[model samples]
Target chain A: MTGHPHDHGHAHAPAAAEDGPPSEYARLGRAVREILVEKGILSAADVRRAIEAMDARGPHLGARMVARAWHDLAYKARLLADGTAAAAELGIEMGPTILKVVENTAAVHNLIVCTLCSCYPRMVLGIPPDWYKSRPYRSRAVHEPRSVLAEFGTVIPDDVEVRVHDSTADLRYLVLPRRPAGTEGWSEAALASLVTRDSMIGVSLARSAHEPVETA
Target chain B: MSDTPLRRHHDMGGLPAGRVERADHVLAAWEKEVDALLVLLSRQGIIRVDELRRGIEALPPDAYDRLGYYERWIHSITAALVEKGVLTQAEVADRVATIAAREEAER
Candidate 1:
């Protein structure tokens, strides 16, 4: 509910016309935003703050939740039973949308997708990676999940079932990836470090304790 | 396409497509702005999230296919604003023209 100081500076304006005229969609978007700000329906500051809030969210939060669940069987049960409340217990507000935590286990692998659109668990994991929204991903994830996972270098054994969760409703899905072996005594912080965004999204596995950590 | 049971643009799950390439492109500046605008509009109750989704789904198939992730959001937000009578198409066009002219002058 805070207002941002209105700066007339065009610092954040779209790039110069050389990139070809801003697409019609972009032009109209800018126009609508300007009109809203001009009429006092919304302020530049309000928008900036909202953007900042979104920017602050990232996979670290989700990784922490995963690590905590990995260490505490009771907490893992709670997380699986009610993702929304469990996330709130860890100081993450999931907003109005319902978040469902799906676990990856020995016999099954889980993958998340929004067949209808780019519905994501942004509250915990921030904005989705670009590939998650691509037509290839949206289509392929559910159609041929194992192949899609392989593209991300995640190969599932033939004995394991691949479960694809299509986020077609209000429920957003986050994968509670199987905790990698060889880290039985690792601290929660160390364990969380092994959780990458792609792993939470179920496209890749969490890094092992001995493996180097990768960032998105 | 005709054989597929799910023809809706948003119902893209379980269809055949290309390989999943892993490339990380920094979000464009304008895209960040648009994302903020959409979040603000929804937060203020000026538009509902469901309405925004419908707006995106309402885009023509070709346009929907052509637009990038944030570009689709831009189109949806603009359409929602116009549809809600928060802004008229003419006013938007006029404002866009003015902004375009201003950018021209700056260059």
Candidate 2:
């Protein structure tokens, strides 16, 4: 079950990034990159800087935003109203991407997927997980969402309707998981620790008050 | 990639597929380079993200399956540059051969 069992039937890991050699396409990438630098189309330093900047981002940024929303209702209203502007308030660059934050309520559980390539909230969550770009997730998430959630060990009760958001290149979606119970009066940093990347993706819920928060 | 009324292959929403393999992996070095290249390209207005997706979707079904996420991306990036007349096909081909030979000699 590692791969999609669709028109193509095989079981492969989503991304064993370093398992193989530098493929022909890999060499092509290097060649293209070198060519670009040689012609001054883009400098090598620019590429390095871009990578560093992209890698510097992660779910922690999204966690901070979510934690703030939980602590302040006004921020929550702002986040839902214009995500790009709200993110700017915290200095998270949305650039040209229009951000949409969906909240999970008692009656509804939201899941986000990019059926087209792997369009994700990279500004907030960094790079998406490899499986998020895999065929299975792109294919099944919009249809059998409940089953997909179940596979991720997230079970939404039948009473709670599952809403699957199909993201596009113009807009990206992030799920603000419901604040877990027993977290009353928690500090913002402590509350942020409970927001995992998967919870933001809506594959699972935020860590509960009793769940061990990773201090690292 | 187009404003086509028809559905594109990448548009796989609601389709039947296998179970999701809920896992994550650190990106490979080359993948990061590819990612950076695309980002710079977009920032430089050389290629838009939508154009990249179009190039990716235009890939033959076999190559689509054979390559990983960034693998497909490199091809698209290369194609976009060539399309923009920024780089020629022969130059890229020759450069790839040279790089491959150098790597082989180093090994």
Error of 1 at A119 (Å): 0.5
Provide the DockQ value for model 1: 0.61
**Tens-digit lDDT string for candidate 1 (A2-46):** 122224434444463333556666666667778888888888778
lDDT of 2: 0.85
Work out the iRMS of candidate 1.
2.7
Write the residue-wise lDDT of candidate 2 on B17-68 in tens digits. Answer: 8888877777766677799889988988999988899999999888887888
Model 2, residue pairs in steric clash: none
Q: What clash count goes with each model?
A: 2, 0
- With a 3 Å backbone cut-off (N, CA, C), the pairs that clash in candidate 1 are A4-A45, A116-B10
Please give the fraction of native interface contacts (Cα pairs under 8 Å between A and B) kept by each candidate: 0.76, 0.83
